[model samples]
Target: MLNQANHDTDDAAPLDMLEAYFAAHGWEHSRSDEEIVASVKGSWTTYELRALWREEDGVLQLLAFPDIKVTDDRRAGVYEAIGLVNEQLWLGHFELWSSSGTLLYRHAALVDGGEEAELSLSAAELIVDSAVDECERFYPVFQFVLWGGKSPKEALAAALIETQGEA
Candidate 1:
């Protein structure tokens, strides 16, 4: 069980599971927030930034596929923030539903790559704060920051939710 106020767990839960999964399949990729943001800087447009679906071989796929690593301890908070940021971006009602029916409203921020990452501290905070301010405008839930670069949780959580999502 998880307390609403805090998600204090002894283990990273989904992170540990996803880490093993990625390592087994060789899909793990690591980069600081800076590296990711930089990769997408010039390429980031409104559609790209708030993409709800992914294209594979020109085929449209759900947003929840494609393994993405997320840092742990920030799971719940991060998804909550995604919703906030979505609203901020005016992307419309975006939500990701897990198989267990645990509805998670989130956004997929694809951080590209570059030197900009090494020199930008405020950009990192801006990424998070902007989401919070936007989501706070409508939803009361505090933001959850499951940073994939910082923790392995994002990939793990996504995988688990997918198992249940298909149900």
Candidate 2:
């Protein structure tokens, strides 16, 4: 458990806690008034994670970009694959930004103001970790659809296959 005392200051902004967590873990990150952008390395790729603190709605939103680019021809397949991937996710959902064709995972935590307004460091860690984990897990599915020329259903099925012991 993180020592809540260190984050109990009344003047602390939500992003402050996140910045602290990133610094403590030695993650390379930059912070603004309402957002923190961090680079997290995972098994498949390094993700660009952005955490935004919306004070008005008391929401902390996280977006993790896997740095995948979906060309116009592959948009339909990627969209279909996103739908299939989202169904397996119990936490965040994957989205393809239409204009940029960037695939990202998004999740949000509602902190609600007052006594519980402050976001805990552990919670911050979990949010970031979950996004990165999902991105890595489903990265191959997207690859199969976009470049391997596999249909959404076929891509999902192939990506979900698990083998027993290492060869």
> Which predicted model would earn the best TM-score?
2
N/CA/C clash count, model 2: 0
Cα deviation of 28, candidate 2, in Å: 0.7
Q: Which stretches of candidate 1 lie over 4 Å from their true place?
A: 1-88, 91-93, 114-119, 140-167
TM-score of each: 0.26, 0.88
Candidate 2 Cα misplacement greater than 4 A, ranges = 1-13, 114-116
Number of the predicted model whose lDDT against the real structure is largest: 2
Look at candidate 2 and tell me the lDDT of residue 71: 93
TM-score of 2: 0.88
lDDT of 1 by residue, 28-144 (tens): 333231111111111111111211212222211112211222344444554654444454454323454433323222433333232111212233234333433333332222211
Taken over the whole model, the C-alpha lDDT of each candidate is 0.30, 0.86
Clash pairs for candidate 2: none
